[model samples]
Target: MSPTQASRPSTGRAARPLAALLLVAGAAHFARPRTFDAIVPRSLPGTPRAWTYASGVAELALGAAVAAPRTRRLGALAAAGFFVAVLPANVKMAADWRHRPTPYKEIAWARVPLQLPLVWWAMRAGRKV
Candidate 1:
């Protein structure tokens, strides 16, 4: 088989999941926005909800771009950058919810480190594929 054909399946391994995850996560930003609203750090500029919407739009766009084979290379890079960009929010979420109830608080704390795997995935998948 040619190089193009050989490379197809490997990239697919990462592209499909990245696309799907971004799509769902982006929609979730709007669907149950309050959950996202609660996590925004007050230290950041603008209203939490507004930031929520902005990020949602970003995610939606990235999701679509990453899903398309033509745009996957750039989309993967953006997705990785996006993951890094949101690290602060995840940290704030963990701190803000630290004292809350069990499941909710645990979830909040979990988000903090969760970025690692996500970042790793994005980087690994986002390459020349």
Candidate 2:
């Protein structure tokens, strides 16, 4: 194999973890929807639950697309945008949880910065094709 090919992960391998993460997080939006709803920025139109469910659906669809070799590139690209789009919610979470106990506050704050890596991972996964 060429040096570039050897350095990059196989498409399936590179996409699986990201697919799994999206799938699980999508499922969580249904299983414990209120948690997700709580983070939805209040400034958005409609109810928080609506945004939560919509994002969950988007995650599931993106996960499915990413899991398939044929669609991985598009899915991963979309996932990168998705991560960026969700930053507001993470910021809202951090702001809302500022008064909570230390651990909870820390987690909320950490989520804000964590999106950067997620965005990078998705972009890298897209390029693996």
Give RMSD to native, each candidate: 2.3, 1.1
Worst 10 residues of 1 by lDDT: 120-129
The lowest-lDDT stretch of 10 consecutive residues in candidate 2 is 120-129
Colliding residue pairs in candidate 2: none
What's the true lDDT of residue 22 in model 1? 95
TM-score of each: 0.87, 0.95
Candidate 2 lDDT over 1-129, as tens digits, reads 999888777767768999999999999899999999999998999999999999999999999988888899999999999999999999999999999999999999999999999998888777753
Off by over 4 Å in 1: 2-9
Cα deviation at 95, candidate 2, in Å, is 0.5
Model 2, residue 85: distance off in Å is 0.3
Candidate 2: misplaced stretches above 4 Å?
none
Clash counts for the predictions, in order? 0, 0
lDDT of 1 at 67: 87
